[model samples]
Target chain A: MMKSRSRWVYMLLMLLIGAFHILPFYLLFTTSFKPIDDLSSKWVLPETWNPDNFKNAWEQANMGSAFINNLVITAISLVFVVILGALAGYPLARVQTRLNKWVYNLFVSAMVVPPLTILVPLYKLVADLGGMNTYWAVILLHVTFQLPLSIFLFTGFIQTIPRELEEAAMVDGASRLGLFFRIIFPLLKPITATVMILTGIGVWNDYQFSVFFLQSSESQTLTVALSTFFSQYVSNVGWVAAGSLLSALPPIVLFLFLQKYFIRGLASGAVKG
Target chain B: MEVGGVLNREKQTERLAGMVGRNKRLHPSAWLNLLYVPALVLFAVFILYPFFKGIQVSFTNWDGYSQTFSWIGLDNYRRMINDPNIGTVIENTLIYGVCSTVFQNIIGLAYALLLNQSVKGRGIVRTIVYLPVIVSPLIMGYIWYFFFQLQGGALNDVVQLFGNQPVNFLDDPKWNVWIITFVNTYQYVGIAMVIYMAGLQSISKEYYEAAELDGASGRQRFWHITLPLLMPAITVNIVLNLIGGLKLFDVIMALTKGGPGYASQSISTMMFKVYFASQDAGYAAALGNLMFVLISVFSLVALTYLRRREVA
Candidate 1:
């Protein structure tokens, strides 16, 4: 009887904490659907459900184009980071040479160094290279900053796979590149998934890089677009709430689909760091 | 057979080396070098060169626009020392860092302990708690902005339920920093909890059983067994929170914009203003360099201290 009583207390406590986390999301979604008249008075639910707020947000924020820009940048950056990260990580994991060890350490150290420290000069370099306001510029920067962690994760992962397959394949007259593609690359699916979720969300949700690098309205990513939208519509609560929800949907949906890998990825990354 | 296969491959590599007219025996594949070239070039051009270039820029009088500006040694650093806003920025940053780290660890550990128990609906609870972590901080900040609004905000509505006057949470300077810290802690405690849960799982069940057998209380067992064993998670959590809090930009940008007249400005936000708003790139670089040094020193000190505790 005492044990059951204590379990109820625990359940109540957990429920309270869960409610604290969910309350803002509740407010956001409900507020988005609220009409302007209901926004300042109603807290729990909208008096009249208004779906047009999303349309207003999408059109006014220029989020339609912003979403496409973000999708392109994030997709291109993720592909490059995964492929290049795997290529670089494979050598670091397999080779015992002094150069490889030094290179691996360099990448690891880069992970802790704040990327903002180099933002000024990087901006200058990008401008000099005529990369400002271009997708390739932000794509390259994302790939670069995201590379260190991706490489670290891939290297740690690849170290666990046995090398006998590669060696045997090499002895069977398979070329090294062919061996990697046929044998090693396919084996990297799990880590690739982890890297993709980790770095994909990072690039998609990045604000600092996008704000600094992409200056044009046409080039603005979803995050920048949303921030600009909020400032412009600061007085209109319903529209701003709708904008926030739309801005948050992609990553939240992705997280829901890949929830298991997301937790494991964060845990492993934290443990390793 | 494995050893013979390796030797045979070495011999074939040597034969290939001879055929290529190179004296060195190729053990590691040359294709590996080719694979690393792109990563190396990207790192060199984007990361390596820019870091050194930033250091050089910090000493200059360049306004970020002019192509030609003479180097002025230590001038920007000296100005940073004398700048009145520097003190507030540093103090706010330190408070944010220390408070966020403390709260995140304590709250996260509590949640981890609860979840570690055999609770029903553990999976659902964990998912809900960690959901905010996956959401972008920019949006999280805006979400909380609505919550903290005076007239129709959720927080104000809750306050009114108790017959209390609505507090202006964001606009008031006194409560602004704390509110920011709270929001930061809210978003990130899940990460700390997940990490602590991982740490807790690694502790053997026998330790607790042994402690119970020795008649040690739950509190004693926690301090003696659990806390000591959880040092690694503690280290990671503290360092991450400290660095994250110190370099906080997005949430502050979305929520406050370092507003109410720079009362809640952090070093990063201040640096952004100096560079873009003030057009003083050299000074901003100096500030960024100072932040770099501060982060490096703090991380190193915290790591060493926490690691020593783990050993002891």
Candidate 2:
């Protein structure tokens, strides 16, 4: 085939694929803008756009509180995962010991195991520890699950950082802490960016853990809140659609801001590494 | 030979001396070992503890709340063996998992190849195509369910335009499985696409050019060069999808709740029902244990055998 024709063919195929991807979002966006009276109508295009649904859904869902709760939990989880993950990864990557190797395997193996397998017992354990219905409880759970993946990825990335830099730092009488904080950590910006974006998306979107762990409305994240909305009013397409669009906005914004790093991180996590 | 032996002896002695000096200087590493204590303790308390506690709680006649119950060892596991509901759930989970994994990978690979072609607007398409994968599955469930709503569903509406009967994709067990698989593929194909695209990008164009020089056609080039080169990504995608399919809960929970008489439930969903909703903590633990074993065995087998084929 000629180059020009191939380009057209490729763009056409991509447009078809884009249609599948865009349709659901289009449905969601359009439905969210529908008037309450026209909510049931399957209009391909909204006859009249209604912005009131957003205000109503936000007020009814108390999404302001949910948004705050989600921010707190995700921010805390991301901070810990990045800081501790880097710390843990540095030594685990540099230290050549039998125990560290075993620990590395243990962490990697945790990835394949489903969180649901341990959910019931985890509920009991948290209740016993008086952590139920608390933001910290959900935050802690998120950190635990996210740690292994971050630590593994960081360790792999850290391996590619040459030891000569650290050796030179040591020659300058820099302490191990100094060498890490000053040299290694700064060198890990790309990997750190990758981890932040990757884990950020995950913690933000997590529902199973958030739903099961967070008991009260006060501590609910966007996903669990949206899920509970579905159960309470299954037929209210306007409210559901409005709530979904609101819930999707933050993550979509996040992905857009970090699109380059997001793709890089995903490539490493899913393909490169 | 004598000179080589003498050099080796000198090197060995030097290595020992360096190790001793390093050991004396690295006393802080022993203290640094305590760094893992927090993570390890958290893992044990949250993950390991819950895993084992489920086993202990399962063998009891406890109602999940009270602190007073007697041991009923082997009873819950025994009951599960004869529970006919468990059979249907197992069948549903396996079929859903296998079908989704196989087809998701195929579709994802196809998209990856298409996206890899040098074309204008590729970046925008990649961004748009990935939008679905990033959405929460429960939300996707609601959206897709609307599109499958018999009379008014977009799917049916389109089908009707072609003069066909509207199918209830989410109601019938047979159709529900297909619908569930479709949703999973829709949600995950983007991930597979991105990963496969990364794999594709890693391959040098020189290989394709060389293949073309030898009079190889598109199909032949793909068969001889692309598939083998993409094996690493294939294994990764397959394992991820398999594990993901097996553990799927939100979509199934949101869409059907293992409904139409337990026709769409997965092992994970079954565990949820028995443990939380149905109040069978002990039996649920047994199911959880079964999942643990199944996942571990499959992962280990894949890592040991399949991963060996990836190029270093």
Candidate 3:
């Protein structure tokens, strides 16, 4: 009897906690569809559901352009980060050279240092290179910051792959590059997915780097654009809520679809440290 | 016949190597070096070079523009030390960091322990809990700001149900920092919970079974077996939260803007304002350097202490 009662208590507590987590999203979603007059009240559901807010938000806030810019930057940066990380990580994992070991250590230690410290100087450097307001500037910065962690993940993963496979391939008359492309890279699919999602979400949602590097309205990423939109339309709660939901959709959808890999990636990345 | 063929192939490869010369023998590692160039060049230009440049810029009176600026020899640091707002900024930062870290861990661990049980809808519940973690903190801040706004806000409406007067959660100086900290905790507790759940799932069931066999109560089991075994997760969560809290910018920017008379100003937000708004680039660099040192020290100390407690 006591056990059953305690189980009920646990269920109730979990439900409440779940509610707390879901409330903001619910509020955002429901309130986005709310008419302007219905926004100021505590009522969650709209008196009349209105889907026009999304259209209004997209056009007025320039979220369409912002969304496309974010997509382009994130996709490009993810490709580079994953490719470069795997390329660097494979050698560091397999090779026994002192240089490889030193580079691996450099990547690991770099993870602990916060990036904001270098913000000012990095901006200046990009400006000097005439990279200001360019997608390449943001993309390169994203690749740089994402590389350390991606390389870390890749190296750890590649180390687990047996050395015997490479030897067998080599004995079969495969060149060094051929062996990697045929044998090693295919085995990296899981870690590559993890790296893609982990870094993809980060670059997609990044505010600080985008704010500094991509200052022009044409180049602004979703988060930066949404923030500017919010300040401008602060009085229009329904419209702003719609914009927030729109900004949040890609990541939330990605997380839902790749839930298993996302959790596994975070767990592996965190505990190994 | 196959063995002889393999031996002949090895000899043939030796001949090929001889033809290719010693340069060809060094080809693999050299190829690896070529693979490493892109990442190396990017890091040098964007991360490492800027870090050193930031250090250099902190000593000069560079207005973030102009080709000619003289080194002021620690003038920025001197001004930073004497700035009256520095004291409040430090206090607010520590409070924000310490409170958010503690609450996130506590609530996160509590949720993890609860969800570790066999329950209906566990997967869905877990998904819901972790939803906020993927959303941008800047957006999360804006969403929560509605709840804390003075008039027609969610929290104020809740207070009205109990016949209490509405409180200005964000406008009040004393309450603003705490509100911002709570918002941060709300967004991040999901990450902490997910990490702790991983840690909890990793704990062997044998420990619990043995404790039960020994007639250990649930409380005792949790205290002895669970807490010690969870040290690794605890360490990771704490270090992440501390570093994140120390360098928090976006949420504060979206929510309070470190406002109501700089009462809730953190180091990063203060640095941004000083650099851009006040046009004090040198002093801002100094502030950034100071923050870097503080974060490094805090991370080192926390990692060392917590990692020591993690069981082998």
Please give the TM-score for the first chain of candidate 2.
Answer: 0.96
Tell me how far the alpha carbon of residue A171 in candidate 1 is from the true structure, in angstroms, after superposition: 3.1
Chain B TM-score by candidate, in order shown: 0.88, 0.86, 0.89
Cα misplacement distance, residue A49 of candidate 3 (Å): 1.0
Worst 10 residues of 1 chain B by lDDT: B19-28
True contacts kept of each: 0.61, 0.52, 0.62
Candidate 1, superposed: residue stretches over 4 Å from native: A39-42, B1-27, B160-165
Name the regions of candidate 2 deviating beyond 4 angstroms.
A39-43, B1-30, B159-166
Clashing pairs in 3: none
Q: For candidate 3, write residues A1-273 as lDDT tens digits.
A: 998998999889888988888888877877789777774564457778899889999998888889999999999999999999998888788765666778888887777667787777877889999999998888888899999999999999989999879777666766666677899999999889889988988898899898887878898888888888888988788888899999999899989998998988888778876
Writing each residue's lDDT as its tens digit, candidate 1 over B77-189 gives: 99998998888898888877889999999999999999888998888889988998888888899999998978788888889999999998888889999989999999999
Candidate lDDT scores, in order, read: 0.86, 0.80, 0.85
DockQ of 2: 0.49
Cα displacement (angstroms), candidate 2, residue B221, comes to: 2.0
**Candidate 3 local lDDT, B85-174, one digit each (tens):** 999998888877888999999999998889988988778888998888899989999899777777767788889879999998888887
- TM-score winner, 1 or 2: 1
DockQ scores for all predicted structures: 0.57, 0.49, 0.56
DockQ score for model 3:
0.56
